[model samples]
Target: MLKDLAIIDYEFRQILLAVTIDIEHFAKIQLLDKLEQRGEDGYSIVSSFLESNDRCNKDGSVSNYVKTEIDRGKSGCYTNDLVARYPSYDYPVWEFMELIPFGTFNQFVQFVAGKYSDKKLRNSFYRLQSVKSLRNACGHNNCILDDMKSGRPSYQVSYDVKNALRAAGFSETTLKTKMSNERLQQISTALYLHHSSASDGVVAAKGDQLRYIVKRMYRNIEYYEKNDVVKSSFSFFKQVIDAWYFNDD
Candidate 1:
């Protein structure tokens, strides 16, 4: 379970960072047009980021990204200087994306969807927020499985999980298990996070890695089932593994 969790988290983080870079790049390009339409200024752009949000820091201190931007401004910053500071900040993409004001974030989402027309990507800004929330839970070592005995907050399963399950041959018996019955919510969220920006190579390699894990998990399940052994918590773990049907192709 730990290994699997690490894999998912690692892949998700890579994709999240890639997506964030793309988002920030596109936002800078489209900012002037959006500013004119909304009658805002460059300060609004800077303020809309997470650095400007007081609630973002648990210690009530400004984020390192914000401080870095401030320091650069003291040295006579240019417009491009503001853009350069964003990528260098050592912050999680999850928080970075959320700190953006909703309206501004929405426009960015629209910009990406309209420009790319990539149907595989989620166009809803809210889905990006959901991915961020998922990333936060994984980063904090929270229980991701909905029915697992955990104190972590429960999450609504993404539709992506159901679709993946369908493609993977979800069984009626499997549907009754805790892993599946919980709605495959956590795995689905992980899938969406990866699909949001992962390249074909990364996704394929990760999928192959998961296939090995699934095989091992299935061996354990079969041994327990055949021996009439105690149905341990690992049974739920196996069920979750069975639902992972991701394919790069």
Candidate 2:
């Protein structure tokens, strides 16, 4: 029973991680919808605005707008400034795209709520925030990834586990099981963080920095479902990607 319970935690951690991405696809479709809604004339406006800067400003600097805003004293866009600051970078570095749609954290939250009427994007944001705090605790808490090998149970996930359960409208004590893939849950949450980050197409498109973080999840599910680890370990993600890829079919 204990093993089964642990496994359930492990499994749902992965599942929660996976389901949370509903917001991502939500964001992407929102983006595309926003773009198409803007249409050619809208794109021309974005383009003309950029014409004032370097020619290939494909990074989307849109200096004309920035300068106009700067003159009015409304200038703080995170993209260019954070790279210069070596310390105390409070502006969610990963959330770099704030210059555009969902222009700020509050706006992003509002976007989620408006775009997704039923899901309580605000609650998810807080849950994600709680998970993020737990992640910080996990990442910075004395048990660095190096120490987890000692196989001791520490406060690695106490708060996060409770908050995540509450987010799911469930009980906080539900996290006591060892069978769960907390890592995957963390991974999924990490992915959400990465997506919600302030950065953009230039960075996120780089590769699996995001995926690698989440991959540690699904350890138990992997063990039971495989002759090898990799396949079962990320099976949840595999199914998701596959379905997404062929979704149009």
Candidate 3:
């Protein structure tokens, strides 16, 4: 579980970072137009948003949080390569994207997506909330399989995610039943996003890692045979892995 959780977190970060960088590069003109409409400068959207006081942090403003991250980056306590790459007190979108926590990156994604009014990007931001929740749970060493009941989720699962699951051979009844469980829904959503967004090389590497985990999972399968909830959940996730990562189609 630990290995799988770590890989999921790492892959999600890579996927989100790649998407954000693509948006910064490919949508520069559209972003500039949107900024101009709001009377914000094109030089630094991050700076303008920080100045607006739109979002507040517990410590101070969002900018304070950003400054703290930058200071941490420069403190030489982080990875040597990361510290070496730290900007000299001036964080561009790209630099900040690398330095900030996953939760902060999610907020940044929402900010940029909202500014551009892109439906697809906005949907991605919503989907990422689940991934973020799972990532935080993993970071805190929470028991991932302790609660497996259905019928209570804080948010609706994305339609795209459901479609992907369906394509992976999940029945309509199964979707409605299993996805009602928040944790399962979040896990499936994260897997869907990673499969759809990551580069082929990344997908292949992670798939191999997941397969090894799944093999380990079944090694003690007899222990969970009587526990329908745990057993079914494992089976369901294995199907997802096979379809999304190993399928030729």
Number of the predicted model whose lDDT against the real structure is largest: 3
Sort the predicted structures by lDDT, highest score first: 3, 1, 2
Alpha-carbon deviation at 209 in model 2, angstroms: 2.7
Per-residue lDDT of candidate 1, residues 136-171 (tens digit)? 554565554323432333444445554555555666
lDDT at position 9, candidate 3: 41
- Candidate 3 lowest-lDDT run of ten: 19-28
Once model 3 is optimally superposed onto the true structure by TM-score, how far is the C-alpha of residue 131 displaced, in angstroms?
Answer: 1.0
C-alpha TM-scores of all predictions: 0.43, 0.27, 0.74
Is candidate 2 or 3 superior in TM-score?
3
RMSD of each: 9.4, 14.2, 6.4
In model 2, the runs with Cα more than 4 Å from the true position are 1-121, 141-181, 196-198, 202-231, 237-249
Residues 150-234 of candidate 2 have per-residue lDDT tens digits of 2333335334434544454433333343214454445434444434442454233322333333344443444545333333334
Clashing residue pairs in candidate 1 are: none
| Residue pairs whose backbone atoms clash in candidate 3 | none
User: Least lDDT summed over 10 consecutive residues: which range in candidate 2?
Assistant: 142-151
Of 2 and 3, the candidate ahead on lDDT is 3
User: Which prediction has more favorable lDDT, 1 or 3?
Assistant: 3
